[model samples]
Target: GWTYGLNGELRKATRISGIEDFSINVFRRDFGLVPIKVATWGPFVLLNMDNEILQKDNIDTDNVASEWLGSSSELFSLNGVDTTLTYVCRREYIIECNWKVFCDNYLDGGYHVPFAHKGLASGLSLDSYTTSIFEKVSIQSAEGGSKEKEDDRLGSKAFYAFIYPNFMINRYGPWMDTNLAIPLGPRKCLVVFDYFLEASFKDDKAFIERSLADSEKVQMEDIRLCEGVQKGIESPAYSTGRYAPNVEKAMHHFHCLLYDNLIN
Candidate 1:
């Protein structure tokens, strides 16, 4: 079961003339529900702004805008309106997987893409891997299977990119951007996926369907494999795992960072 709440009546009381006023009231109210899980995904909340009713009046759509735009709560009054406003809380829950493990597997692509996801990476032929690191971040790219030339022929082929801390940018022929393995808990995670593409990709519905199917297959593979690995990690049989030279460098880098932070 999933849940959320929006005290519309409460929102109306805090109404002020501008965003600044709304921020003082609506944005500050401490809603009681503690978030056990959260993920950076689209539509966490959406407020329709720049619309007719809103634009005609000198209304400060800030309170509503803030909530949709990253404001944690709703506590403002409409700028030009005199009546009370209310909101409906929205939320949904699905599946069983922990946060940390999901993050680890998501960040560490070395284990599965080549093996479990042969369907997707088969052509990529990733024998070894390499990484680029920053002060507190790193980006890992898999070694070859398909030639860069072939990718060009495909018009826009797929490639994997990992942005440290918890962001993944998967470029599937200029059509997809999915943030896989966002932590929801120590054992649960949320995979956020979005699709975009060149006009060519969109024109081919069959290709679009095939691509989406392939993506789903790869994701399902990841979920199953990560879950199994999680079970194995709890078994006492394995206390730690080693990185295969540069093959698993991302994982090693992650572990080193974790150690540096926790131990310091």
Candidate 2:
């Protein structure tokens, strides 16, 4: 594919295969630009421009979402059926905070769920949640709470994956979504949530509405908490905080990645 640029130059476009879970093709004038990785996972397409700092990562097959694209995939099977999922909805949440703060809140993995997100906490059993830290990826999973019992569509569990830097994939029953945490400035960021749903539920208006309502509530809570943290960090009285070894391993792992990239 090709398109005329602002200056009337014919820009060339091509697809970069096998990097992302999906197919990604972009138009650019020359090869000087970074490589774009397209990852299509569970009905959503993720487009990423490879960061030179972390391009050398050796990701595990289990942790890579693209592996699920295979006909023989097992991790994200829908009721034992191996098939591709369908696209659904998407929304973005803008936050007045450093991108790290939003992600840090995500990686905290403890304490905040019960206290900060009361409504969302009802749907999740914090006691059942567990986090597994990997080389460049992390997985957090938990069994459903009361909400699961009410919704027959959702299975008995949910899992979330965090790819290094700023990408997140969340899977709940037959629904999946990815969060691209794009940092706009030092204290501003945009968290784009692209939702993918099982094609079977495409016409279920009530189900979709209920699901989105619940998700929006949780997102609002996160925005409030993260925005507050960003403002709090500017306080002269507060410098740094401690991390609980068992509960906060993910946050530590994320920080280490940032430090390594900034230094070397």
Which regions of candidate 2 fall more than 4 Å away from where they truly are? Answer: 1-83, 146-155
Which candidate gets the maximum lDDT versus the true structure? 2
Task: Please count the clashing residue pairs in each candidate, in the order shown.
Answer: 18, 6
Candidate 2 per-residue C-alpha lDDT over 1-264 given as tens digits, one digit per residue, 9 for 90 to 100: 544555544454445445444322323333334444455544445455557523754434344454433332344454322236566778998899999998898887756889887766666677888887766766677777774343444446777767788987778766777798999999999999988777888888898888888788889989999999998999888888789887888888899989999999
The weakest ten consecutive residues by lDDT in model 1 span 75-84
Specify the highest-TM-score model's number: 2
Q: Residue 93 in model 1: shift from native, Å?
A: 9.7
Task: TM-score each candidate.
Answer: 0.56, 0.73
